[model samples]
Target: MRVLKRLVFWMFGFATLILVTPVEALEKHPLNYVDPFIGTDGTGHVFPGAVVPFGMVAPGPDMEDRGWSYSSGYQYQGRSILGFSNTHISGAGIGELGDVLLQPSSGTKWTRKTVNFRSSFDKVTEKASPGYYAVTLKDHGVRVELTAGQRVAIQRYRFDRSGKVQVLLDLQHGILFGDGPRVLKSEVKTDAVRGEISGTVWSKNWVEREASFIVRFSRPISNVITLPARPGDRAPRLILEFDLRQSRALEARIALSTVDVAGARANLAAFGQPRFDVVVQSARSQWSTLLQRIEIEGSDREKRIFYSALYRTLIHPSDIADVDGRVRGPTGQVIKAETGHYYSTLSLWDTFRGVHPLFTLIVPERVDGMIQTMLEHHRAQGYLPLWTAWGRETWTMIGNPALPVIADAVAKGFQGFDKAEALAAMIATSTDPRPNAPAWAQRDWRAYEEFGYLPYDLNEGEAVSKTLEYGIGDDAVARVARHLGKHEIGKRFEVRAAGYRHLFDPSTQTMRARNKAGGWRTPFDPLVPTSPMNNPGDYTEANAWQYTATPALHDVDGFRALVGGSSGLSRWLDRFFSLPSLGDNKHLGQEALIGQYAHGNEPSHHIAWLYAYSDTPERGYEMIERIARTFYSDRPDGIIGNDDCGQMSAWYVFANLGFYPVEAASGRFTLGRPLVSKAKLHLANGTVLLVERLDMKDVELNGRVISEPTIDYKSIMVGGRLSFPHFTAQVPKAN
Candidate 1:
């Protein structure tokens, strides 16, 4: 009987340990729940490739053709792989940088036709994680696996049969905006004995810059071929052939550098050849460290969406500096990085709204690095960047969005940046009408300086929208100036920050486009979108009705007064939400509508939070809850629009955390219902702020109940528990 009892006790103990071990491991990590493919389909335009957090080499497959679907190089519906490129742009509207495209082929002849060499891939067999991607090519019967180091991309090809296998390095196959081939300088050669190829391709698109690469293979090549450039083609194809067909596996390493091929070679040497599994494991470990910063408790699906969103947010603003800290500047000069890292691909217009603010909370280290990059751009190009990519500025969007990034970082107590240089850059861009500035900003510069608003009579499309955006930019500059002790400059900018109010017509109760004579434009319709093809329309991408809530960001009180009062504001919001305009809002760029609130774009991100200040906290909670639930999901088509350099994803991150950065660089977050049961924010100051959604009636911090609808940056940085109990409209009076 004693022996039998002992056996039963041991068996029960083993069973209990088995059940608890997995749960403990899962509780410690949320990275495994990340779905990299969540936004790859539909209009998400995110790349499902192998990259560490802010990696330089985003190695992925490019489709056979160019279009909106191929913006990120690879679309989920694309069936063929022309070649695997070492560098790519993520979540961008324009397709560029399929540089150093390497493809494995079995034949000797180089064919121009994509069907001759491009392999058909099975989407079902494709597997992707935060740091790894693997797909099987049906034509060559080769399995391709991709993983990356900080500066190098490693591709491993497993072939079914080996004999005269060749790797194609196609420099001519790249897309800029559409199906038209991009122009490039001719300089490419492959060395047979060394198994290496080095060259540079200078492509002109939205930004004209050069990309140099060094590709090294593990095996010796039997032959090398360089095809001649076709008609009107400046770039030609280069191929390397391996005679060892009996070998089952082959490896290739592509190191990209914006400076020079030598820089690329240095990058390859920094990450020495490691086994495929070791490289993949290193990538996974790096991503795991970054993703574990925010620990969340929620359903499996919610965790998947949350972690995936977090993953996408970190993919952009890539580190362009080589291992030796050398990078090509916007002026075609080789500039040594001052901060040990220089990042490129600044999608400032969209990211300044939410992504950079979230970076201030979790990845403060990168925030400082990004700010330094902007300052470096100013030093090299004489102006701050609005839409920078590959060390070149593109005239893609309007206003000075980089201002908010700097202001938000400074407001959040982040250090390690040159504040004086940042201020100088902001002032220079605000005053100077540089020819390279976005056309709208340049065309309306005079009106903006004299009339304090972009006038519609100038025939500048998007006059009102640019006015609102410029106002936000001015407000950011004012906040930063005040922080730097420039009281007079701060005061001047503060007055200028009210530029949006000039367009607000009291009679219409909507911000309208005003002519040079300071009168609202006639025949105005609030439901019409501005001209998308070119500027000169009243708005940029939205209608007057959709943009009506924008001024609420800086002047919530004044905005309420403009609408009449709290009651009037509430009634206006009710009509806006219940109105039927959303059903007919087929604007190409606008998406994810709840009535006129376009959740898909950045302008409407703050509208749902307005209810928090409208004397109806309950309405705010309900609207935010609905927005969170209805607009987001954990699938391939999860995103309703372009991730827009992770701005859309950042909105989800903050909204799920129970607060939102309604105003750009305002240093204030308005309250909303948090989706997670509990979340612990690990701030840069080595403090933890716990957020809990308890089933009670009061909102409390650390133990005491608080009545304020808004929280400042200092409160969160100091660290404590922000508990939101059951919300109701009958709560304590507003503070």
Candidate 2:
């Protein structure tokens, strides 16, 4: 009787807790499950969207008229968001694209090319955690929900009344970088629509047009509305409108089908579930699993920031076209998955720098898969991509961080491809003699591989950027060769690392832009980071003062010399920042105070870490903690910028991890602040890298290695649970 009573009491208490408690996964990974609309309303160009673990499709809408900008994909400047699609580009550098565009329009209600359609914020319901988004368009009175599986975008819409609900499907959507739409064929039927769309964005080669739809209306109504009242002509779109009464449940169990509408409807029948609660529930579970990968036990605030950061990182490299691995290729024919995998949208150059590294630790399985994708690029294209979007290399952002990413992945034991082939590709790419440039220009890649620097005379037009980039390449090369056991190669690259000295004007005590002839570029002003004419000489899109000092790494001896000494350098930095904004968003001055440091771009990514290289790494930690806490918030406009895919989040993760990746290739992590007091990173392997007794000051106060800890961070091993600690003791400010 006593046992029964106790059991009953326990069960009753459990039931009560369950009844009273909110959803467990609601905020498990706080930001992960965020309603992406917070900052996306009208502020930042962010999309209130959804995505799965490294999936290639981010199906959203085309509402805003901001003209295909990356972040503000569906500019809310319209009355009604047209429809949901299979793919979308997020926070892209240049512009946006609404791919596989589908809409529920009236008989002939096509969104005017210029009509503004900004819906109230209350209409959109975005489940940002795992991968789900549902919105009720106030203008249309339609309830839309979206979810993502491994490689699919599932959409369901409930219409109050099915009154000629034309489901408009447009093939020609994306930004269309350079290649125009090359849709081979499109097949649209009563219950389905399938098509193939492909064209070049940055390069000429490769075709992709794979789309599928499985739509079921409350009652089949009107007909398919396509472009022009003509046949035997290509129609850019098709609209499916239906007719039904109010209070009718219109369930759209749509599935992405690369094959055909038949396959699509079949797929829908197979997986296009109709339950809204079940769909959201499933999505929550998916996000829960992904976000929990790098679980952190911190304050609610820290968890919020951490999960949000993680959420942002998963926004891009979206699932572009086709589901079930069926795609249209260079030839105007539908082809099955060649490698048993379909992929698209790669921001590797910017992302591989920090984003890919983050994945290395969190999503180890995807690491090898991503590498394989890059390797495929090497096989298809002549070289590994610098920046690829929509199945083509964009060649934006310098530095082939692919080398570092693959090296780091392999080092961390992610082996799903042929390392030898990967190595060969890296070596082949590294040995390339010349970067694409004008005839008279000194080749960067080749000179980097051969002469250790872009020879001064060779760099006639854009000299400074050449020198700096070479310095970066040298760092990447050194790290690669050093780890790959190419000792001689590493040594050679290390020699090239000193090329920054070519710009080092000893007499001026600054690393000014120097001419190839070993002379300071005359009529020079260190503050003007750009070229001599000052219009656009390509000092890597930034002026002189910001690029001159290499503070991010432990270039103690180098920076010391440039400023004539450590104190002098500190004093220079002090004066450098004490001034007002220099009238440039790139410099981060007017918005965020700093010397020449530009939070708007990538050049300054290492600037905060410079303090780590300084005599006071703790100062770096202080600065990082302050910047992260100040700049990054928990709102729609939370992040200061595009999160640069993951660079921003990378900074936070490393800062929270109590370390920062200061270099592209170097395994060395400059110490920084710990966002969490106690954080453990569960690694694939069993061992752990314990970061205990860590305080913001611990990195500086105990500068000396206490454990014979010559951290041979030639490359990091992402093995297991990493603990980010908070120390009780605080280091005093430098006297």
Candidate 3:
């Protein structure tokens, strides 16, 4: 009865509830289960701000310090908010773009100190939904509500008493480059008749770009106060003081554009000036419609965590192009999207693992757009993008991540992308020696051609990481070629995909860096963890034990053989998970450790599935189940590590869904013990894939028992029922 009463209360206040008894209750909409604050407290770095799915504008609060904890611009532990900004990065290790801040204040003297004008708020008064956030400012006795459209952020401020209220637009406020972004151009002008403040800000921190925005208010302003500044200089702020004597509520609609101020105006015009409640309703509708693609049956807590993770997966690889398809290219040229909407902020090194695969499942239309964008980038530059921001290839992380994504799309029979052009791009990236590009951007094809792998002594790079990633890329290329019936290209790259073997050291039974003389680097400590980037002789953000388990996606049989067959591999995995750490000096920031397996990082992402190739498949199930339960939650500090632009959240989404993609482009997903009782995947092809867990060792597809536990992309896309009769953690012999 107590549970029933709480459910009733939750239905009215928290959820979109339907009246029914507990035994006959209907599953809640996925949007109703999302908790935006899950990753805001810990090192998860996810901002609990308002954003539409794949929307460019992530409007949220910014803290005083742009330190590691506040990388996303908002931390749950923060006591006060400096201001609300229009742009925010979600779950990234680096910080950028808290651009165009607006603070609502009452009785504020003109002061440059942010602390003086800041407002403190209690967590109890704060509320966040899919596309809305609200909090009561204790200092100003005002209630601020935030909601966003595709390109606009609407803020509604409700004051307790009617008086003169000021809205401060601070152009100098940003969360990048230590304190603030370097302003290259700033212009803030007011149209008194229209009650609008228009501005253009060109700034450079992580990436140099331009943003033009317009702020329109509900009431006319009595005074326009531009803060004092030196001669021939742009002031950082513009204060609009309005006499609220006639009304107690004030609203501001802000729109951003990467092109020009006119573009911003056009965006605002297209969004329509709906009332705050209507806008909030529209935002909620959008989220509810998008999140309804997947249906899962679980407890309230499980549903909350699952939907929150699903929300995070759609936040990045943002749509950077405007409604007119006009965007700034890599070289700052005004490029127009010829085919579809061009997107930016591709964290390929992290996202290629799980996030993109999720896209291929439910949002294949967006996948087509991403491929078109990548091809456009290749046309603009010489090669595909590594990690892009604002259409500029940042070369942030290692590997040709774009290859696997494109290959995966092609393998799944996703159309509207040119396969021949994609193959040419892949070959060009692999063989072409980009002399002018940075060392990090250019994959050393000459070293690869000569040594078959990235030799530590020969290349100035993280040898093991480069070697493993290149092999994965090669395998992806081969899969795409074969899928297109280009057998020659497939066979050629199939041999190249075996290059990971060159790094395998039989004596140590782990992948190690080989010197110019083909000898293992002395002091080869497989158990001792080191930063893969800093300790560059062998790894990148991981040690030998972790890197050795990689590239198994395409060659698990060969990998098992190299580790002395299934029994030997099983023994090594046991050692890898049992030992906590080698020495007292634990690697800082390398977290979510299970033995040498670093779940916090991307390289070890596929390790949990490798045990399926061993004799002890049950061990893999137990490890995965433990990881799913221990490493995630629905609290403010729910996530265990940096979400890595939704990659961490993507892992959770897959692990809880009963399967995961082991290979990026293989078009196959390996099975694991399902965490939920049942799930229905609504695919883009207008078909539903149903999964039900039963207590048995055998599996079935559409009522026909299957020999293998894996499911192919074609099977999932075609849509049918998949059943697991039983899930148990008992060791069994390999099939």
lDDT by residue for model 2 (1-735), tens: 654474456446544543576776434534344445533533234666666655555667666423423344554344456567665565554454455655553223543342322344363353444567777766555667776654445566666564445455555444443343434455544433222222221112122344555444445545554555224223356555556445334444435544556555444455544465555555555555556556566766566667767766766554333544554332224545434454455766456556766676655556665677667766655456566555555455455556666666655555688776776777665665445522533334654444444544555445566566546545555665666678897787667667676666656555565434555567766565453233545365566656666433324456656675656656555545454445654222123336666554555666766654345545556666666666666665565555555566666676676665555444445555565665555444433344444433223222443221113242235332233335322433211
Q: What lDDT score belongs to each candidate, Candidate 1 first? A: 0.78, 0.53, 0.79
Candidate 3 segments exceeding 4 Å error: 1-27, 111-115, 177-181, 228-235, 532-537, 582-589, 728-735
Pick the TM-score winner: 1
Off by over 4 Å in 1: 1-28, 107-115, 438-444, 534-536, 582-587, 727-735
Give the better candidate number (1 or 3) by TM-score.
Answer: 1
Cα RMSD of all models vs. native, in order, equals 6.8, 7.1, 5.6
Candidate 2 is scored at a TM of 0.78
lDDT tens digits by residue: candidate 3, 637-734: 78877888889998988887778888778788888767778988987536789988976657778877776757888887878888876565443211
Worst window of 10 by summed lDDT in candidate 3: 14-23
* TM-score of every candidate: 0.92, 0.78, 0.92
lDDT by residue (tens digit), candidate 1, 572-666: 78777776663433234567777777777777888888887786667877777777777778978888778887888988898789898887587
Worst 10-residue lDDT window, candidate 1: 726-735
Better of 1 and 2 by lDDT: 1
Relative to the true structure, candidate 1 reaches a TM of 0.92
The number of the candidate with the highest lDDT is 3
